[model samples]
Target: MSLSAFLSARYGRGFRDRAQIEAHHARAFALFRQRVMPRSPFYRDLAQVPLAALPRMSKARLMENFSAINTCGIRYDQALDVALRAEESRDFSPMIGKVAVGLSTGTSGQRGLFLSTPRERALWAAIMLGRFWPSLARRQRVAFFMRADNALYRRLSNPLVRFQFFDMLTPWQDHLSRLEALDPTVVIAPARILGQLALAGPRIAPQRLISVAETLLPEDRAAITAAFGVPVDEVYQATEGVLAMTCRAGSLHLNEGWLRVERDVIDPATGAFCPIIHDFTRESLPILNYRLDDVLVPDPAPCPCGCASLRIARIEGREDDMLWWPGRAGLRLVPADAIRTMIACLPLRLRDWRAIQRGNVLEIWLDGAEGDAERPLRDALADLGRRLDCTPPELRLHAGLPPEPDAKRRRVRVLPA
Candidate 1:
């Protein structure tokens, strides 16, 4: 599927002209407004305000009124039941089928259920193929890192594409074993996990590497590409759906055809935003003008890749992952990625560390050799604390930091449970 052909089929002739993207967006928004207003009482009431007068709906508001948001007959409680059942059965196709329901992994304490129509799913699949592998016409094997395999994967009929699911919940060693056997052409996993794999060295050589389901740290990106000898692309997908993806040039481009992303700037000091997203692809549960807590900065300049869609320089990690440490006045939340960045600058002697917040104290655990290992790590931690204007908390040393059951290693965690 060539980009031009895919866009023409999906958006008609207007897609070729750059100005028509906004025009297409306006048309899709109007159609979404009409379909959702009558079928979904939740959206009807919320969207009652004039299109020009509608206030931004925040994440808190969406969660509060989740049940009423869906146009489908299924209530919020019912959707939860259906989603859980589908996940447990590992046969999500029947529950989703022509409908698209992707459950949030719930790492941030709030799990969300997103619903999309068959048209949306097809469009999504087409866009993904068009963006990622437009050059490949022959059959290509893809190793997908997913928590649960869904029917959507089973039903995809592209003779040139074969997808193999690699469960994220399994141990890394086990997944590596499976990857060795599959010998897939493409590898996709979370950025942190991909970094770990790179550190372990490559057992399989894949032509393409993709990171999804989490933010891709700058350090991780370099490591993955160096290990695989291939440029690593990022798919900015979440429980909400596929939001954006990187082009061949490694620039992040918005999925403009399916969703309208309105960016809200964060205070440089606070680093928080209320993102308003209008999901044109969602009809079963219309997420019209829905606000997200995730923070992002829209790129002002055109991408070097020459894609017409909007670009984002970075997709900062989740809001909940922000670190809160005690100060003289009270507790303060700081961007956790900053700590990770600082640690990346230090020598490789300090292999891994995890931050845990308990009461007024933040504990930093260092996992590496004993002598002088703690010194550089502690200095780096203190420097980060000083830069963030917060006093450094307790620092400790450990033989090893246990991995989360889900196979994700958290750089920052809330403690005192």
Candidate 2:
């Protein structure tokens, strides 16, 4: 499909009402099922199967079944070798023929390799430009900060758009001067780096600031907006596919226009759900009924922008971030959102922080303001304890926290098995 024509038809729908969104999504889902079920061996036998009856796919399952899981016939071992070499050499142009090959940090402990056809890459770029670009007609200088790179991300560069990839492994301080020099019209980075950039003043102004890869914590968003004087929009994407993004009104709306999401409820009361995503846009690696570990909370109210796609209230860190401790009867769990809420409710501006649960002990790291950290810290702990209905874990405030292992930083890490 022609990029311009695809964008016009896919995004021009305006998604004015819920009915329209549903109609668009249904058509997309139906087309995807019909196309993928026949072509992909992973899904061939299930052609006549209902989606709900299909076994859910996960990162582990995908990796184990990698060869069969992909319609592209690319071997997992070969792809991993290529992706790793690219990362090591800092040259991402190499691909499995015309396909785009990229590696994920393996946020869940196992590295993931993703493949995309040339057509898929173009579609992704077009979709990104269509959804996130400040305007279609106007030229844009986009600075994308990511740990790795691929031809897919670079494909958008042209006379109309200047796309630059800032490697996260490189010294960030060195890039500050270049950042000021580039004067990017749009800046995209993980939430942590975005916060860091915001904190590193004589601030550079950008028409648009987008947070990707990491959860856009409320505190981080507030800080970015305060520093940049621009609304910090977010793109909710993963190795799975481009799942969701912020609409014009700045609410995070699921990209239900091109993907269908099945909510696996973790907590109905909190509106927290683990999504089973079926991405119609991904042909190389069709992600049908694929389950992810991340947790998302849906907003009940309709967006002011009138985007009928499922709107998200917040992206809770991860399902694994939930802490558990032994109680009289059994192990009691403290929801990840509860811990996040406690810290967010505190009066301090959390510069950088991490919460790690090691058995019955909770290790808290804070790197903000010098004054006494105990009072507000204690209050937050009290709230956490009250909510969990158990004595809070031994809270120890450490002076320094460990550096992040990858581009994706988890504010909350659960260490105990």
User: How do the predictions measure up, each by TM-score?
Assistant: 0.82, 0.91
lDDT by residue (tens digit), candidate 2, 127-239:
77766677767888989899998888897787889998899889978888888887888998999888889888744779889898888888779988999898998998888
Worst 10 residues of 1 by lDDT: 8-17
How well does candidate 1 match the true structure in TM-score terms?
0.82
- The Cα error of candidate 1 at residue 407, in Å, is 6.1
Q: Quote the positional error of residue 162 for candidate 1 in Å.
A: 1.3
Candidate 1 residue 142 C-alpha distance from true site, Å = 1.4
Number of clashes recorded per candidate: 0, 0
Candidate 1 structure quality by residue, lDDT tens digits, 135-223: 46567778888776654444333688777787766677888777878777877788886787788875788877888877787777887
Model 2 quality (TM-score)? 0.91
lDDT of 2: 0.80
Model 2 ranges off by over 4 Å: 1-22, 324-337, 344-350, 387-391, 403-405
